[model samples]
Target: MKASTKNVIKSIAVLSVIALVCVAILSLANVFLKKEVTLDKATVKFLNEKFATTAPTTTGTDSDTAYNEDYFVMLTDGELSNASGYTYKSFKSNSSNYVSAIYYAQKGANEGVYYIESVSVGYQNPISVVVSFVIDNGDFSIQNIAVKEQREDFGDRKTQVLNPETFFYYVSLVKSDEDMNITDADIIAATGATTKKSVAGLNRAVTRAIDTMNKIYTKSDEIKAEINKRGGQNG
Candidate 1:
């Protein structure tokens, strides 16, 4: 073969090898990176364990029926908190869409539970979180709180907001009627996450939800009165 022919063949062979190597590396990285972006089996189980409840069985039934389906009764348009008419907000982020919802149950077996789920902007991406506030069925004093899902990343270091124990410990400091005083220092101490962006974002979002709830509770009398007026009209 001519010298030029041999040179072109060698160049083609080198390019082929480089292409194959690049594809292999990408495939390998995808295996691990994909799991981080989506919800995993553990997170699903945690969400159910925290928010799931059983349905009430009828009389003469030996087995208790689990009311897992249709358990959450969303507040109606007029019943929604003063924040917005809908319980859930489709919040659009810079690159992705995050959701924030507020659900309440008053006349069911799951009464006294106020479900709040939100996604707040974090260090690198949006942190999806779900919190369950237990009430006394008559008042808004949160008896307990539970975090269902929290996904956050910071540079090369990811946060453990999904870790049930640690996440709960940090959330315990937040109260229903009281204002959250979670400072940058507090977040760094508790979560070891980003204090400037991630922590602040989470704090502001969570605090706003809490404040909205407080406003609803404080005006419970008026809201209930309106509900009664509507009920009387329907009847």
Candidate 2:
């Protein structure tokens, strides 16, 4: 081959290698990205499915079918406090992880309830749960709970956190005026959760959900103001 032809061939080979490397990097990035994003996707799907009946309807649809709009609002720390009226006392100022998102059940049996989604580490992986908190006359309490995901296999012990009727045993552990500082020891003492590690995970999650509810209650006035500012009236 001529010198010019050889140079061109070498350049093409280098370009091909660079392209392959770029593709590999992008593919790896996508996998890691999905690992983080999958939790969010699952959270959204869980919220929508749980609150599907009460979702708002899109007027232009051919049929009068109501659409489940993305109801979970992931508020920043400032927005959660300043904008959403979340109180500082309800949650531990030093603690970092808790209540990742809040969902409003707009129109159904759960009409005015707020669902707080929280996560805690289990024996193997993170445990995510959503609890419905009802606000009535400035008092807030956990009305129901749904476990979105739990990585551990707890055998029959999962019933302690999964069933609402039985789960109230855990809710009863929380005090309205105080922060929920439940530990593994507390979880083991309060209920028949087989594995202390699993029980502790669920307890921490439940406590966090209650904390979010209490914060909203403490700042009920601010929350009302926020609602009114957005053209909504506090019920």
Candidate 3:
């Protein structure tokens, strides 16, 4: 009986050791594989909490690009104190387009930002993004595009073209006005999408964001009034 009890204790100890090793392996896997907020997932208040800060920007970011991750987080994050006292407003799309929702806010006195949400409709698996931007009165300046919910592959194509070196540079040459708008072909051109079949859904999705922002900035009576009240600066 004494021998049997000793054997049982030894077995239990061995089992406990194995169990701890398994747990350690799992913990390491989880730490390495954790995903970030709102990437490839629809924009939601819950998923966005993790994306509150911008990842250190990529290598190609232009010094003039306005993509302020903090401004976007501020626009979407209701918890943050609005030191600029920006009143939140929603602009709906009456036209037949994928422009889902639009949110605009002014930071302090002159700088303002737009959170234009759009979704890719025809993709096998749809993707979305908030084309966050600042309209420079001097020229077209895209601050940052708050990425979707776009898959890694297609979404990468969309931005690779629109990045500072490619799309912004290309637009600077063709544009005749300081208008904050883009043509459907702009994104298609940006991604270098080819004929027959391609990743062209992002074309309209991104355009919708820019178009919506322009409509509000240029046409909205209220926005004009507010701009005049603040001395008519687009920062």
Candidate 4:
């Protein structure tokens, strides 16, 4: 072959290689810039349906008021204090305890993931629990909870029978209106009833209190299970 023809062929080959490299780079760039599309349509529809049914409707105009209606109403509406003057407060702070449900939609797609997050309260000695949920593809539900801190009135108790740990449990039950109200009921029932008052009446009272708290624990577990089920449906 002629030298000039060989040089021309080599140059053409180099240009072809450069063009191929440019095409490959552009293809990768397009992939990176492309929007993520959710592949699950049924799951997205289920989430939307579930949210429409379960989500609270708020009519308030103010941002804070709307937020309170949407998030804080459930936590505050229940009678946290009973006739015993016991009050229950969540260990999670206002900013932290806030529950938010978010929905993502693609520009041209009908389905996307939903995110939900909220705080749940639970108890342990010298430590209170706050749970945060992060549900992928649906709602953010409580994935796990951690011990935050002890109750506020951990050490201050007026009654000697009210040991700090047990007392906290007792007060929590009363505030939450759990079955622990039976503590006073059992005490009242046992009083003046000569059948069982003969031996260690104080021990019976303590036992009643402990039993009531145990009932609260059982109730709490039931509540947690329900929450988890709801979360699974979406998250």
Candidate number with greatest TM-score: 2
Cα shift from native, residue 90, model 2 (Å): 10
- Per residue, candidate 3 scores C-alpha lDDT tens digits across 1-235 of 6999999999999999999999999999989986423312123331232223354322123212322322122222221113222222333233323555444444322235555677654345444656655566633444555545554245433444433345444344223323535454654565453321223445555566666555544433344344344342322
- lDDT minimum window of 10 residues, candidate 4: 105-114
lDDT of 3: 0.44
lDDT of 2 by residue, 1-235 (tens): 8999999999999999999999999999988875432224455456546433334321222111213332333333454568654533345423334665665644444445677777777666777778777788777766656777776665544535435445556656654323666666665566656677677777777777776676575665555445445433212
Off by over 4 Å in 2: 1-45, 48-78, 84-96, 154-191, 224-235
Q: Each candidate: what lDDT?
A: 0.50, 0.58, 0.44, 0.31
Best by lDDT: 2
What does candidate 1's lDDT look like per residue over 56-169, in tens digits? 221112221212323233444455534343333323332333435554433344444565555666565556555555545555644334544445542555554434556655
Q: Residue 59 error for model 4, in Å?
A: 22
Ranking the candidates on TM-score from highest down gives 2, 1, 3, 4
The candidate with the higher TM-score, 2 or 3, is: 2
Clashing residue pairs in all predictions, respectively, total 3, 0, 4, 4
lDDT of 4 by residue, 70-186 (tens): 221111112222211222232223432322222222111112222222222212222222222232443222222222233422444222222233333333333344333445444
Off by over 4 Å in 1: 1-48, 51-69, 81-99, 106-110, 134-139, 146-150, 194-196, 219-235
Candidate 1 backbone collisions, by pair: 54-67, 55-66, 55-67
